[model samples]
Target: MLPEAKYRFLSEDVKRRSGLVLGPEKGYLVESRLAPLARTEGLASVEAVIDLMMRGDKRLCEAAAEALATHETFFFRDKTPFDLFSEVIAPALKPSRAGRAMKIWCAAASSGQEPYSLAMLIDEMSGLRADILATDLSGKVLEKARAGLYTQFEVQRGLSIQRLVKHFDQAGENWQIKPELRAKVRFEVGNLLDDFSRYGRQDVIFCRNVLIYFSVEEKAKILARLAGMLADDGYLVLGAAETVVGLTDALKPAPGQRGLYVKADSGASAPVVFRSATAAA
Candidate 1:
């Protein structure tokens, strides 16, 4: 176990770099997350990892942050948002972008599932041309996403058997996303704490489930940046548990939609409104 002081310091360090808050109760998490890294670096213990990190070992500190920052995500996670994308957002956004390619940004894309799922949906549309840019804080996960490979359990989660057979090729016990689907999306390492202006405005932004880790102040700041990066009529999809309420004035709930948000100035009207329905379990 890491000493109380060292655990506090490590917690603060993680927040400084990644905006993930870890309280004293998370000491076990800290120890478990960093123990393997310590071993891989030939350090004797988690305390040794912390010692080097506190001593200005940039690499060790980053490794610790990445380990702690990793989170679980599955394909088509929280079906409501994807359902809204397919049933409402896509059909509505298509006409406005008749001649140009629509851009979608999967912010906080852990591994590849979320963005790849979007790619599959877009490919199914007859006249829609779309590009998906998926970003994550951890380079390790981004590499895995770029490889487009998944174990059996990964493919089984939320992936319909027909979709799986259509989009993936078997490789031993794992499945690799088809080359066409893989080619439609690009993966990069991005930190929400940093500037995102360079990615250009996106037609749809999926920043789901990631904001719950941040403080309210950080959430507002991140939402402001997202608002700036969205097109006038673009859609924003957050996790089912997340919302724009009380966070920032830059976004408002899309009327009748459960997990969808829109830029506040986008002139949302009754014609686009639809009542919320329960997401598939």
Candidate 2:
């Protein structure tokens, strides 16, 4: 595979900005997403593309970051977590919502599907309410998320036919999510590594499938920050393949679940040490 010398500096910038580590394997992805953009602007090659990026053009910087990050996502991409979100997490947190409204954040929401799926689940439940803040590092994906458009394959992967009919309408050959459902979601461009001072506290955060790209050190930093963002009784949801092993002690596996972790109570915030590498058991 070719080293991404063309966008190395910008790639480093993305790592600094978002904590998403992109190595050589991602060179094709950058070339693929940005080559056309470069050609359209009459630039010669990927080196020229990086040159434009280094010049501090905000649009190029944003575009280059979007190019390197993966945006492939679907509604309820993995069903078990959503099941856990609805069945266990929400009910546990429901009683805590006496007079205050609940807030759920999708920290790495890609193209809005995960968060929208969450909103749809809430919509299905009567009076069990919450607000959703879906954020991604790439404004391009967030814009697509706000648009609520989906190709047939994108809609069918995890979205059930019944829910599909209820929440989407056919627009020519594509599906468009209903305004009522789409309106419930709020999309923003956010980097999980940065101080989330503006995002406030949350009851649940779905940061699934985004951590695999980070170094273990980066993952630890991101997890520590997420631990702070959770309210006393909040939970953090990670991808099935992701783990909190070296991250922090504030999270422990939800009882009877393999990939889920709940925030430990106030006194339990100390770092969890292990005697063995197999400590996850």
Candidate 3:
């Protein structure tokens, strides 16, 4: 067990820099995430790792950041959000823009699963012109996303047997994503707490399950930046349990959809008034 002082130090460091709150229940997560780095550095424990990490050493700091950012994600882990994307979000793109192409951003795309899942949905739409921009804080996962490979179990989670057989080809014990789907997604490095100017305009943003790691202030800041990238009519989709209430009024709850938010019109300065555009039309 990490000493109380050590835990407080590490937790405070993480919270200060990344806004990731580390409570007592998540100590094991810290140990597991940082153990590999400690091992590589010939350190004996998480305490020693923390000592080295806090010394203003850029390299150690980066390693610690990567460890904290590494997380688990599976293909179509939650079907409802993707279903919302397909049925509500995707269809809402202007008809005149059908062949003009649409942009989808998957923030914190771990190992490519979520973005690839979005690609699958896009492919299912016979005539929609869409592409996926998947980004992560870790370069390691971004490379994996670019490679489009996954272990059998990684591919299986949240993916039905039919999707598995249809979208992935077996390579020994691993499954490789089909080229057609892989071709539609482009992966790059991104910091959710930093500027997203490189991402260009987006019609849909999938920032699922990421904000829970951030402090409330950080969540609000991220929502503001994300909302800026959205077109006036674009949508933001967060994790099922996450919400933008009290974070930003720029995003209004998308009517009849549980986890969807639409960007409020420019020049507006209040908590978004929830109105169903579909109903209004």
Candidate 4:
């Protein structure tokens, strides 16, 4: 078990670097998440890993923070958001971008499923030229995503057999997405805490299931930046568990839809207030 002091320091460090707010009660999480990294480094305990991190081991510290990231994802996770993309967003954007390519950003794309899923949908659409960019905080996950390979269990999660056979080929026990499908999207390492201005105006942004880890203020800040990056009619999809209601008015729930958020009338941000991650729980 980590001492309360060490745990607090770790939680704050994680917040500073990654915007993930691990409150004091998450000591067990820090211990468990860093254990494998500890063993890999031949350190005796997670405490030793933290001690080195506190001592200014920059590389190890970033890896430890990356370790805390929740990479739990599967193809077409939660269903509705992808449906909204294909059924609503895509059809709406096709006309406006009749000659140009549509830009889609999967901001927190954990292991590529989200962006790859988007790619597959785009493949099915006729006369729609789209560019997909998927990014994550961990370089390790981006490597896996770039490879476009998934285990049987991973493919089975949300992929139907028809889509699976259509998009992937058996590589031993794993399935690799077809080369053409893989080429449709680009994967990169990105941090939501950094400036997002370089991405330009995106037609759609999928940042689902990511903001719940941040404190209220951090979530608000991220949403405000995302709003600026969004096209006038662009949609932002968050996890079903997350909402922009109390955080920022820069975004509002899309009418008659569940997880999609669109810009508010003023297209401006409201003030953010400090809210503890623990209290949010």
The number of clashing residue pairs in each candidate reads: 0, 0, 0, 0
Look at candidate 4 and tell me the lDDT of residue 228: 89
Off by over 4 Å in 4: 1-70, 266-281
lDDT of 4 by residue, 2-31 (tens): 877778778888888988989777776676
Spell out the clash pairs found in candidate 2. Answer: none
Off by over 4 Å in 3: 1-70, 266-281
User: Each model's C-alpha lDDT?
Assistant: 0.88, 0.80, 0.82, 0.86
Could you estimate the TM-score for every candidate? Answer: 0.73, 0.70, 0.70, 0.71
lDDT of 2: 0.80
Tens-place lDDT digits, model 1, residues 136-159: 998989888998988676688899
Overlapping backbone residue pairs in candidate 2 total 0
Q: Worst ten-residue run, lDDT, model 1?
A: 267-276
**lDDT (0-100) at residue 173 of candidate 4?**
63
Candidates ranked by lDDT: 1, 4, 3, 2
For residue 71, give model 3's deviation from the true position in Å.
1.9
> Candidate 3 at residue 242, lDDT?
97
Report the lDDT tens digits of candidate 2 across residue range 1-281. Answer: 33356456866888876667877676655665566567767888777877777777777777666555646678888799899988888788787785666899999988889988998998887666788999999897888899998767678789889999999989865799999999988998988778886899888888898899998888988888888888877888899999887677767666677677777654454356566788687
Q: Tens-digit lDDT track for model 3 on 164-197?
A: 8888888775688888888899888988988887
Better by lDDT, candidate 3 or 1: 1
lDDT of 1 at 19: 89
Candidates' RMSD to native? 9.6, 9.1, 8.3, 11.4
